[model samples]
Target: MMGLILLPQHVLHSVVHAAMGVLVFWCCTVLGRSQYQGLAIPCSPEPSPGATIPAMCVNERYLFLLLTGGFMGYTYSLRYFLHNMNCLSFPSVQQFKYLQFRQTVPKLLKLSCVQSLYLTRNFAAVYFFLGYIPRKWIQSVLNLQMDQHLPPLDTVRGLLDLSLFYQIWLSGVFLLTTWYIVWLLFQIYTTEVSRMDVMDGIRWCSYRGLLWTDLM
Candidate 1:
């Protein structure tokens, strides 16, 4: 009665978001500085090239913090989808398990599929910002320190750091690809296969790409 009123999907979504919020906050608090070490602005007065603001005055902490927050949040969404799939594939209970497989699992799987595709859309946005915003700012700062003396080509090269862009793109792609793979695995588990064997849990973990090293 109350369960129908409350809506399990809403509850699960809220719990996932709340849990990820804490995780992202902790990651930003602990690992932010190290992550942005390459772009750290030293305390020095320097006339930046074609720059209005001083080089030393620009703060980039907020940029890295935002990136970390977004990255962790979407990453958690993928993990949540995988967790739901694993739970759905677990060996059946003596009685209620069949009921859940018939009734609850489909609802949860549908919700998870939506969550995964929705979260995957954020990959481009996150990667774009990481490339065009934070990296751009770092380049501008570096150019400012150079005092516009460098050639146009060199300046352009400095500003458009392909390596950083590629790294961010790779990370985003990794998360998105993982979600798709897991989503497919869950789809197969639910539709193509009906029964969960004793080895199902282990097989599910393998499908999730949980390697021996990861378990260790």
Candidate 2:
């Protein structure tokens, strides 16, 4: 019997890389242009500092995209962790079976405590990124004018513009910070923590975070 494999967390690892590629392309190429429009496009196609990336300083938006992409990648990891936590049934130990594991049927499904904790953090991100950071980014458009001396900065409808372009990036960033919490909770009471040393589905080596792979 085989349920969905969730451990060693390699299933959507490709998604993590794909998201990175898409983020960079969208931010730096497709929407990227010669002129800066308030929020409709965050950065220019230019890789060099001459690109005049906005957000008060040149190339600032590029920094934001990289940070945002990194956070998004980590968030995907959280989703993978949560999937493993919910799946209680061990169906097939295919991952470790071929690896010469002592037990042919290692934990096919794993519901570890650390994964549960990650799930909680993911839910919290819904509020942190979309709800809070968006408002902050929107407000920053107004605040930015005061700091930077660029003549166009004063005239652009920065408020309305952000929703179209730059806010989209912030939304992703909200995805990252939230998809990104890692800390150990010490429960003096009963602790419901379990870990799978080997995964059933993982193939082709992956560095699923230490917090996930390491036993709690």
Candidate 3:
């Protein structure tokens, strides 16, 4: 019999991760538009307050939301994957059950608690590493004041300041985003392969078990 009744794992992961990539792209595109980021704002010495760009774009909050929500789903998919993978790695009868990730890492799938922790961690990372430290380094090296408060995006200087902050933020978050996509791909690849295998196994077992016994 076929090892699994499924599509190619590579193709599956590509599609799944691509879907995630597209979503991130959409969010970024929306936030980075010329109107929003002050890209096309009329040249002025003063900061223009035409449309307030959400501070989340320039900090770790959005990153927090993006990763926490996305990873939660990724991990949940893993739960499903393991359930299927177990059937083949260690076959079991219908009456048997297996313990999962929770035993090793309690509340791993609890969304509320996990999200709260993620938010706190993201804030700390931004304050110490991703956002604050890098900006400070750049300001000290370039002799620029990165502490400008909500500079109007309509002016050249204001736009540059916002751009600088966001660039640093993006540079940091990009690494995590890349890894998250990779993680998604692996989960999809293994889970899908195991999905079909488990199904075929169940079908074969059912031949002489549930349906067979019932029909007989």
Candidate 4:
């Protein structure tokens, strides 16, 4: 599918997935060491006497969970794209029509469920990773310079600009691919219901949220 091979999109996805994988691997290794011998590997500087290295190690486990969840999400998203394209690429119209009547509905529903689960897991991972990691650790890890006051408006503007750039790149690919997938779903739904009007309903509901977001 043209949606599947969107140049550097796949490459960026691969890099993020690979980085997550490596982070998970390292966390697992650290966790193994910590579990077997009660060894506490120091991460950054000790924040306090009671706040031991083991705590940091545990936090690393949470980070690993986040990364693992992200990796799973990205992996499943790729699989969903592949499956959708495969269905679309079927040579025989008869086979495609038959699938629309029967197989496509169930398959798409299952994929939708899996995608939702993966997305939820990934979000959960990010929540815990961001919430639990110590601020000092984050600063050191990111090599970020701290400001005494809140960052200036210009700094905020710059951050927003960068975020928008990334969002446009990622979301553009996702939306295009998802639109085709949704189109296929509509075809299957219409076939089952014997109602072409359902497509308008589906499209309206799907784009409604996007419309609101764009307006905001």
- Give the winner by lDDT: 1
Q: Pick the candidate with the highest TM-score.
A: 1
Give one digit per residue, the lDDT tens place, for model 2 in 1-216: 023334344546635644763465355433545243233332233246665655433333333334444444555555545555323443333233224222321221122223323433443344334533543464466453222322222133322334333443434433433332221111111132333456444532344555457854
Please list the residue runs of candidate 1 whose C-alpha ends up more than 4 Å from where it truly belongs after superposition. Answer: 1-159, 194-216
Better of 1 and 4 by lDDT: 1
Clashes of each: 2, 3, 2, 0
Span of 10 residues, lowest total lDDT, candidate 1: 145-154
- Per-residue error at 141 for model 3, in Å? 4.1
**Could you give candidate 3's per-residue lDDT for residues 100-158 as a string of tens digits?**
22232233324334443453344444444344444445445644433234442224344
List per-prediction Cα lDDT, in the order shown. Answer: 0.46, 0.38, 0.40, 0.45
Clashes of 3: 2
Cα-lDDT of candidate 3? 0.40
The whole-model C-alpha lDDT of candidate 4 against the native structure comes to 0.45
Error of 4 at 31 (Å): 26
Residue pairs in collision within model 1:
48-144, 49-144
TM-score of 4: 0.27
Error of 3 at 107 (Å): 12
- Candidate 2: residue 160 lDDT (0-100): 31
lDDT-based ranking, best first? 1, 4, 3, 2
Which wins on lDDT, candidate 3 or candidate 4?
4
Tens digits of per-residue lDDT, candidate 4, 1-216, equal 655656587656656654654344344445545321222233444457775432232232233333443455366446545665434332233345555546565665565555544554454445444533443465467554333232221232322433333322232234333534666765555545342333467789878978999999
